[model samples]
Target: MSKNLIYLLGSGRSGTTLLATILNSTMQIHTLGELHQVYSYIKEKLKCSCGERLEDCDFWKHVLSKMELTQEDLSTLSQAQNYEEQHRFIPFVFLGKNASSDYSKSQEILFKALASEKSTWFLDSSKYIGRFLLLKQLKFLNVKGVYVIRDVRGVIHSFSKKVQTTRGPLNTILYYLLTNIFGQICAWLFKDVVKIKYEDLIENPEETLHKVYALIDQRYDEIIASDFVMPHIIGGNRLKSNKSIAIKKDFAWKKNISRPKQILYYILALPIMILNNYKV
Candidate 1:
């Protein structure tokens, strides 16, 4: 069976994790949240959504054992992955160049180990255009991209509240603009790509997922459930560990963000906002 890969392309806090989690509910789909961060998670002994440290998780242990990756190999692959993930390598990736053969090889091995006879579709919510572009160059897998967009105000608000280093409003807007601009370009470059709005996904999940499923030629099923088992994902938002999936839209930016910052985000993201049909 062919390995089918679905990559969610979007900036952080743009509902990629929510979409991935929802899609993971499908019997045939397996969610590998932020697969690119696997090395860091392993190195830091981060906790998986399954409530176990990555080094202790049976699922990850099985996958690492299957790939037969040694500690030295992990360190080498981490460096190679970091190299390929850099913004400079994007052009090379677009030209179908393998900047790091080790990264490519390890990706193949990791994905092969993740694939099973039952689950053919693997969802990687890495949200990096470089990774998406590089993965498209790989011939072993059938790759599809989903460009997820959210209202700039919401994104900026989310970024402001991030406990880790927060990208201030200006930086957040710039990052949002660049990511979605490139995301739009990615959609144009790949015929198998689909674009979905975060608002629409929350307001109308079944319809939105139907559009996503069409990209992979899969029949859409009613997979959203009240209780969801957190997949053995490596990196994603804290919500990944939550068992109950909520589809409620967050309008916090409307009240929480100051008027000036909101206006600034509106002004900075106006072009893409109009392109994506977002309202003030």
Candidate 2:
């Protein structure tokens, strides 16, 4: 492990990308977006936001080379039949372990190469609770967790509009409940876990990030916060393309999701929502 990995854990649409972009504003830290999807990168031949394919991007290519990852290794990682098995391999790769398994050795190279770079820290905003569990087994990483959460209604609203799925609203609400339930569990188990609210982030980025810095043992840099810039990110919300660093809460869910649906959401998410202290 690089001794500087900050893993962001949460469900999608919970502001992981937004927080990562904010952190990347610092020259001392580089935040890689959705790096957990490295297998997807290999499978889909996804293009980096910089317009070059992952294989061709200078930054990714360098990292891959340092990690000694080949197309074959990525394919093997992607081919893991069980989802839990796939996540179990994540921490070892970040630890730069040369384990017998290709998954562990490959990820170790990738993250170690990242640590070797100019930035003092690298933030992996993969947002998977399973990844957090896998990380617990590794001793090499100076790992800390930032559990980014948003209102369940807001997450459902965003997922409904942005994510194309056959799943219905009730299903969405159930998923929100379950994912967050596990996320909270991870936060409770992990040391130095920062339970951050997305609403808090947009309304008060400076204060929120200051708290995050404290969690990760990094000195808060005001200059970086003031003159924020989007660093080269791998895969995340399309909104990352927007150059403006303006921070504001997106409460569109309050107006977008009908009141009846909101009521239904509160009913379904009641247990976990109340557990997280989210208002009904």
Candidate 3:
């Protein structure tokens, strides 16, 4: 049986986590938050959304046992993954080049272990075009991508806020532009890709989810509020740990961001914003 994978692609802070969490409510759909960061999380001894250390998580323990991977093997896999998913290696990946055979084989093994008969589709909210391209090389897995985009102003405002890793206005604009450019290219290059706006998702979640379900060839059902639970997600927004799920539009950017800076962001992102039909 072929393994089915659905990847979320685009810049971060675009509500991919919320989208994935909502989709996880659907039967037979599993969300693996930022699967690309699994090795890093393990290395750093980070915690899963389930509130257990990654190395100690029952789910990851099972995955490790199934893959039969040792600590040393994980170290090697991490190095290979880093090299393969680097921004510089993207062109090579697109040109059908494999940076490391070991990485490719390990990824195949990992996904095989993750895919079970019970689950029809696995969602990876990695949000990177490079990782998405790398996964496409795994022919045993049927891969589809959702390019999730948010308004540039909103993204800028989110990044500008004081956080652990805050980005300046210029950096935020550049990151948004570069990621979306590659994301758009990937979406166009692949037939099994779809685009979703964060605004639409917040305003009409049921309708937005129906579109995502269609992309992954899943039948849609009205999402039940009680079905929302913190799954065995690896790394994502802190909201994943919350017991309650709230769907609301965050228009705080309009109020908090300075008018001058907003105008500058608007001008810088005008082209892509226009392409995405995002207005000021």
Ten-residue region with minimum lDDT total, candidate 1: 111-120
Q: Give the TM-score of candidate 2.
A: 0.84
lDDT by residue for model 2 (54-123), tens: 7788778776666665678666665541244354554554455333344455456556667455337778
Q: Whole-model Cα lDDT per candidate? A: 0.83, 0.71, 0.83
- Residue pairs clashing in model 1 are none
Candidate 1 residues 1-280, lDDT tens each? 4578999998898999888888888766788889888877877788888889876787888877677778898889888887788777777777777646787786887777774764468889998889888777777778999999999999888888856457888888889988998899898877999999999998998899899888888788778565567778878887876876767788889999888777777878999988988876
List TM-score per model, in order: 0.93, 0.84, 0.94
In model 2, where is the ten-residue run with the lowest total lDDT?
79-88
> Best by TM-score, which number?
3
The TM-score between candidate 3 and the true structure equals: 0.94
Per-residue lDDT of model 3, residues 1-280, tens digit only? 7788899998988889889998888776788889888878877888888889866887887876677777898888888887778888788788887546878876777887774774478899988778888888777778999999999889878777775468887898999999999998988899899999999999998888888889877788876656577778987876777876777789899999888877888889888888988776
Clashing pairs in 3: none
Query: RMSD to the native, candidate 2?
Result: 4.1
Better of 1 and 3 by TM-score: 3
